[model samples]
Target: MINSNIGWEISKNEFYSENAFSKIFDAVVHRTIINVMAIYKKHIRQIRHFIVCSMGILLLASSCSILPFGEVLFSNSESVSTQPTGTIFYDDFSSTTSGWDRSETDLGGADYMDGSYHILIDEKNTDYFSTLYRNYSDIGLQVDARRIDGPYDNNFGLICRYQDEKNFYAGMISSDGYFGIFKIENGEYKILGHDTMVFSELISAGDTGNRIKLDCYQDFLFLYVNDSLLDVQQDKTFGSGDVGLIAGSFEVSGVHIMFDNFYLTDITQTMNQEKQQ
Candidate 1:
């Protein structure tokens, strides 16, 4: 269901320039999109009828205005001690000058709208991201995200150690209450320590915002939702690169998500308290 002809259009025009890194990242993203499309073609045959019907609904919905703001229904009471004291980067996305991409196309769009970082993917089985053009290693990232529109079956989360799109780690949660940690190395996507996304009751499903936290330090990775730790994984493939927010669609499109209160800090400690228990 991916639109093969549509290119990755971020909000900033400079990103599509002939810059070497941009070229590499763009290629890697397109490759990932193609691979996901192949997967749907292979495994989604049984649901073809369902997809056809869903597409009709999505098309009609897309014709209307998409609201990127909603009521915040959840809070993270988790101890902030797990995050290091040093703030590497933070953005409330209240200004357009924050340097995140803001572009719109026939496929989708990523922009600073309604005082929040908004990402709308109108293409099925497609992923789009708006990254902070900076690099870091062993960091902690936290954000509040919620589904503004589109299917409940969608993906939205944080990415770390993004080295040229091909090598990176993604910790994601679906609006329908599934979560997973993934690694993309050399353009191949693999879930770390799992076969597929695991169901998690901790995630605030549907239109409610869920506080998400991800820590990438040394060889360990941690994913937290709504103040509760969901998964802890280990990997040594990627160590440092850019970081960002990602949103994608599964069987259906129009996966509109808005992110706010993004804070990035150094990773100073492990989940020792949870481990000892």
Candidate 2:
């Protein structure tokens, strides 16, 4: 489960009870039909409304085929996710940020203060620090993060498959409504799936807490925030390496961010142990 947190745990029975598809189809049909009818009514005098009406009929037909009246794709007995079986390592950060040893700060630093990990970026300069607790080949890592101080124009999230501070994969979310996954090779940064950064409704804005998760299974990487799957892509740059956290400044310095409740589950190790047992 790439934690693309996008999965329906609702059983097929529950799905119908919820009437999700009907609600969606109703809204789409009503709005689309209304707009098409308005256009047809207006253009009827000029005989152009026929094209509009034809389109509306085609749209209605396609919409019916898109989901049909009542058809559920996935159904299950319990809340579900396609998660790999593994041993999970968890830290609520109640004690220290000690094992997060490697740091590269330009004008920023990561601290464990008042029982939470904080990344404070100075306005004087802009940079990020990579804090690695441990490394794994196929793994899933996630952390709870929110802004504590500084401007909303900052970026903070998880860094995984880290070959080093220079070369690694970064999954980043900004307070200004932007999210992206980047491949940093030899200190050069490039977007993974698309050339441009993206904005997502799945991402919470402002002071809201976000649980950013990155899943690394083989060469495929998936991004999930607040339990919603947002992005996915495949790459073959690096395999097994250290995983950690990162924060950077954008508009101003002194960007304060706090992270807690971290989880790192090693799929590789778990699989090996299971074989022996």
Candidate 3:
């Protein structure tokens, strides 16, 4: 009976030892799995942070490209001109170094010159100018201009009473050439007047300079190129406001044009009242 009891106790002890070993092995495996899961979670968090940072950098770069880099000048009420009894709108091309806004057809793919705010149009594409005014009525407008470079068709003029891209009045002078006044109605250029006294041709192919003057009063329109009188046409088609610059293509080289002196006055008033003394 004592031996049997001793054998039973040994059997019980061996069973308990195996059970304890199995429990310890299970605990080790569970702990290793938990540690590996924690490491994987940490790696995922790092990847997420990297992806977010990359997205932020891309967004910042895109924003910088879309916005314009320059200063814009709005209307200055204090800078109003009192002379010529009119207002002068001047853009010295200081702030707006990038050309003004206009149509592609009118712009004609002109290139920008370095260190200057003027658009350079070559003979290949001379029909490019800034559209200054549109849709205005009943005022005498004058512009002060200086010639920079000539040769080709350095003819600078005004587009008046413009109804669209096709219809308007044009008064222009060629460098060392004659003055021309024409009306464009229904997409046709009709000559109103031409004076060769100042210049033999519409555009002088030399380096001589010229000044042009235009006056629109009631139904009477007068144009002067240099010292020669070009046209005195009467037309009631256009009644008022806004003027623009005119340019054309024909072996035309680029020009540096500066417009400063502006005189606009109400001509309906008496001569004594309109005259500036």
Candidate 4:
């Protein structure tokens, strides 16, 4: 009976999740729709009672899903993290920018396309960025970045501990192959750590790909590329603040960047343990 109950509940959700899912996510709709239908049909007999309820619940979940396009697309993205538990936020930019916002003057602007978020940079718009509406702390955040145009001399990566327009920590890498960690305080940019050039093999040469990860726990932070740990930093200049996506131009502009698999996993379980004592 329990097994039957679970199956029905699952299929009900499967049915509802795919109904409106194909609308915003036309790219992977055909295959995903067929697969979801198959699962529902396969388990329909066992979980018939839960079908209606599941449909309602699933539709709700779909509307509110971290990545509403579908789990398949979300799972396949390069920046998606496997967190055992605790997630402050996770997005593929597949549905919509839930809490992320930016102005039209923000270079090329941010938009969702083909299961990813795209930013078109040009000479007129050298650098662009978008940030979450709220600040998040002690979280592991990551994203996949690729230049879609121009020279490989540009830089793109994550912005965390962001206090405002003039304050934040940028964990960035250049396409020509260099990485830097910087802290912008009161309009002055300070280099906290940097590698003039390293991990060329880890980053694609031209308009290709690079998976960058940043884990910020307390005062310590770790940065990674291509699934490999590159460097770590410990600082207290900023505690909890907004997270954002950033791009900068060097040699030239019109350097388009596509960011996907934007994931944020927070340390929620330990929010108040020792301090309670």
Alpha-carbon lDDT, every model = 0.66, 0.57, 0.40, 0.55
Q: Which candidate's lDDT is highest?
A: 1
Better structure of 3 and 4 per lDDT: 4
Model 3 off-target regions past 4 Å?
A: 1-83, 88-119, 123-126, 150-152, 194-209, 226-229, 251-258, 269-277
Task: Please say which candidate is ahead in TM-score: 3 or 4.
Answer: 4
User: TM-score for model 4?
Assistant: 0.62
Query: Candidate 1's residue-wise lDDT over 118-139, tens digit each?
Result: 8887777777776677898888
Q: Please provide TM-scores, in order, for all candidate models, with all chains considered together.
A: 0.71, 0.63, 0.52, 0.62
Candidate 3 lDDT over 9-127, as tens digits, reads 11231111111222111111111100000001101111000000111112211210122213421222223233544433444333433333312211122212222223234333233
Model 3: lowest-lDDT 10 consecutive positions: 33-42
Ranking by lDDT: 1, 2, 4, 3
Full-model lDDT, candidate 4: 0.55
lDDT of residue 89 for candidate 2: 68
As for model 3, its CA RMSD to the true structure in angstroms is 32.9
Q: 46-123, model 4: which lDDT tens digit per residue?
A: 111000011111221232122222122222345454642456577877675454542232223444566677655544
Which stretches of candidate 4 lie above 4 Å from their native place? 1-86, 195-200, 267-277
